[model samples]
Target chain A: MIKDITLGQYFPGKSFVHKLDPRMKIILLTFFIVFIFAARNFVSLGIMAAAVFAVICISGVSPKMYFKSIKAIIFIVLFTACLNLFYGTGDPLWQWRFLKITQSGINTAIFIAVRIIALVLISAVLTYTTSPTDLTDGIERLLKPLSVFHIQVHEIAMMMTIALRFIPTLLEETDKIMSAQKARGADFESGNFITRLKALIPILVPLFVSAFRRAFDLAMAMESRCYHGGEGRTRMRVLKYSKKDYLALGASCLIFAGVIICSIYLPATVRTGM
Target chain B: MKFIEVKNVVFAYDAAEEGEEPKTVLKDISFEIEKGSFVALLGHNGSGKSTLAKMFNGILEPESGDIVVNGLNTKEESTILDVRKSVGLVLQNPDNQLVASIVEEDVAFGPENLGIPPEQIRQRVDSALKSVDMYEFRAHAPHKLSGGQKQRVAIAGIIAMEPECIVLDEPTAMLDPQGRKEVMDTVIKLNREKKITIILITHYMDEAVQADRVIVLDDGRIIRDGAPKKVFSEVEFLKCHSLDVPQATELAYRLSSSGMKIEGTPLNETECISAVIKALS
Candidate 1:
């Protein structure tokens, strides 16, 4: 049901991975993603996967949940694997009248699939440990240097926080309107494509009206509270880097360097014509 | 000093088309609410009770006349924030007014907007939640809460702003009977303990009976203003305006008509019981 749809979901924990500064986690996540794409061969891919698995374990989140997070992209993973298997040009290992699978094709398919899985798992690890508010706080702090260019970092962060705050409210409103319309015998299900779409109008119109009303009320309330675009605003929980964050950052940097070296020095698999 | 003063205020919604008569919602409304007083506004639908409440905080400016709060004119744009800060407004629908997912964060919203330092904001939020007895649910999502709990949280949000007066526009309208009683008790407790002025706009006669003074509105005009007993005593006038006195008051009026002597009008069940017992003695 709708209750199970967790938005910006973060699992709370007290592990070293969870305790690291959010800013450092964000930076490390970005570095991890870049290095994921930089991975050229199986040796580098193995190193990337190992590093992601270690973090995931240290974070204390079950591996099943991490895979479940990537469930939505299962189709993309399979589709890319299929594309790599057939489109890769090399000596054919298996052949039919018009279809062929080469030695290079098998290697390419495994490489692409592992890369996609590794990329997704690493990103999930970052979100799994970092709460949405902390993520925004970290981003705002990281982007503080951009303020010299007159960028409104705090405003953007506040906007994000507000947006996160309203998601549940909006969801609840949508549910209410849907139920109200249903009570009036407005059919939302069991209809043709166009009929079902037309039925949505009753639910949608009221939802939009209520949303706009809430937005206006919230804006007025914010103004009354004297919010004037985040100038001279001080935070309650200021982001301060700790020793744990420094150590995590150092470890991530080492992993990044190690992956690059492995991709260059490690022996890559070779395929000869069948 | 009067915490809120309305002087000959007139307000209207602009007509849908040009050259058409505007819909006058409040016609020459005037009232003064002293600090720490509880005033209830009672009327049928379209009685302009809500319009008057909005005007108190400058949410809707008067078309003519002035509204002064703590000696500051609400018409002055510069003092509008000060006026709003002095008087908090809570709307009927608890769902619409709450802007935060978490209870504590919603309570912190008003003070946070005031740019109070984070530490002070935390204290205000905690105290506001404690005042409403919602401190335990500080981290819980508001949508999962019951109607009465959400309404109380909404009140807590307003209380966190630390306003001198709190104007509620039919806050219990959407709640069940139990929820209504919970909300009313919370309002009464805040007025009693915090010494905050209360301007309650409601249609429920039972609720009006608990206020220090009741102002009845009819078609954007104040038809009656006095204590609940005095106002309900004019049963004929109230009925003419498509309203009714509380059941106990009506029963007492019937008993008095049937050759029984009652010293005063009974606005509630206990009062009626006491009057009946005294009359028998």
Candidate 2:
């Protein structure tokens, strides 16, 4: 069941979106998120949704993946939409004991739901197209200014890279430990909550021991490779903006400006009610 | 043309508790590795072979003596990186050694650490992968690879650094038979084709037999050091030191001891077969 997780998974593709520089992609995503929240009337939200759909199509990732991401957060979408349903101040569309649904509430509920879905889909597009190492590298380069404050940006990136590299290894180790424990007649399937928690002790102990051992081995290996912090280190896969990245960045800026303009000037017929 | 020289080196780990004595791992070890030599270090667990391996690349400091790699003293802090650069170390566990998720990226790590330019690192990564015969899997995730493949990638990571010597600490200890053969083949190829000095620490007698020279360590001291034939022929001496000789050598020794007129000891399967045939005829 743990193996089925699609969160933060990268689907390799030859799409232009996948070819865009990761730093540029991250910048474009930031612009997108700002515009998504800044959107006011339905016209602006519609434009934002259309923009997200266009990127998702261009990303070449199956629509099913976006749906999977949305599905993972379905509970949050429903809960927030329901809470917004009764809080808007407008003409009552329905009335019942403690619950009065307004026209504005209906609009707000739909607006929030669509907004949430757009957020989920656009972010999914970023992760789906970019590899994890590229994503971390993009983040590290983007956050380079933080080093002025002694934030250790490179160290953070190094830690992130190592963590990602070890995730699958650790997961495999966990699976092996669980199986080993199971072979020794340790039951993890049937028990009360506390008892189940107690049953995890056997697996956890060995997993921790092995993780520490791996960490030591990795440290020694890193030293042997002359890894003396991030100072004087050069990257093989350096992030550089290409013509396509500039074009994509420009296109994103235009769309964000268009959303803001449409929200201020468009007719208020389908306005977002909150 | 000595690539690495160890002069009476000794190493010990600190005491685990305040009242306990520090445990010595390597005791007054001295050796010289010529350029392009293939030397196998043989010892059982805790016999200081691993400790001696670390000393070659300055990963561990000797408690009393000195180790010089290509004339750079390992004791100096400034030359430590240079020492490591000249002598790449391939560790036993392949899974723990790879730093990058992707195979090529992992191979590029050593070069990147040395601050090589991006283009040079790319070329090195490619060539290193090709040398290990893993170039096709350059973009594949390391975790998904088989044990032998992962070990090759680990070796590629070391090879990309362009080190003159490589010291592997029982690299096949965690691998299966096939994985062991794969790693052994790669190591031998590197030694013969690349002319890189190889110091292989292993307990496997067959692997030791394949080396140009075998140095046997027992209880933190060298017991035998010579060519494989010269070393393994003393089967009784090796057995007395709690080590095993190659199967063929043991059989030949037993046969000769049982009063069969075997002309000489055999160190491998082919030699053993010939020896037996000659004895029977």
lDDT of each: 0.84, 0.91
B1-281 per-residue lDDT for model 2 (tens digits): 98888899888899999999999888898988899999999988889999999889988889998998898999999989999998999999999999988899999999999999999999999999999999999999998899999999999999999999999999999999999999999999999999999999999999999999999998889989999999988888888888999988888888899999887768889989998999999
Interface RMSD of 1: 2.6
Can you tell me which runs of candidate 2 are displaced by over 4 Å?
Answer: A1-7, A266-274
Q: Which ten residues in a row have the lowest lDDT in candidate 2 chain A?
A: A265-274
lDDT of 1 by residue, B1-281 (tens): 67788889899999999999999999998888889999999999888988887778787889999999999998998888788888888888787777666778778777766668888888888899999888999988887899999999999998988999999999999999999999999999999999999999999888999999999999989999999889999998999999878999989988998989886999999999999999989
Q: Give me the displacement of residue B249 in model 2, in angstroms.
A: 0.4
The two-chain DockQ for each candidate, comma-separated, is: 0.44, 0.88
Per-residue C-alpha lDDT of model 1 across residues A1-274, encoded as one tens digit per residue: 4545778768888899888889998888899988877787778878888998898889998778897978978899899889778866778888888689987788878888888888888889888888887888799999999999999888888778778777877777778888888898888879799999999899889988888888877775565444557665555455788999888888888988898898779765423211
Docking class of 2: high
Query: Each candidate: fraction of true contacts kept?
Result: 0.33, 0.89
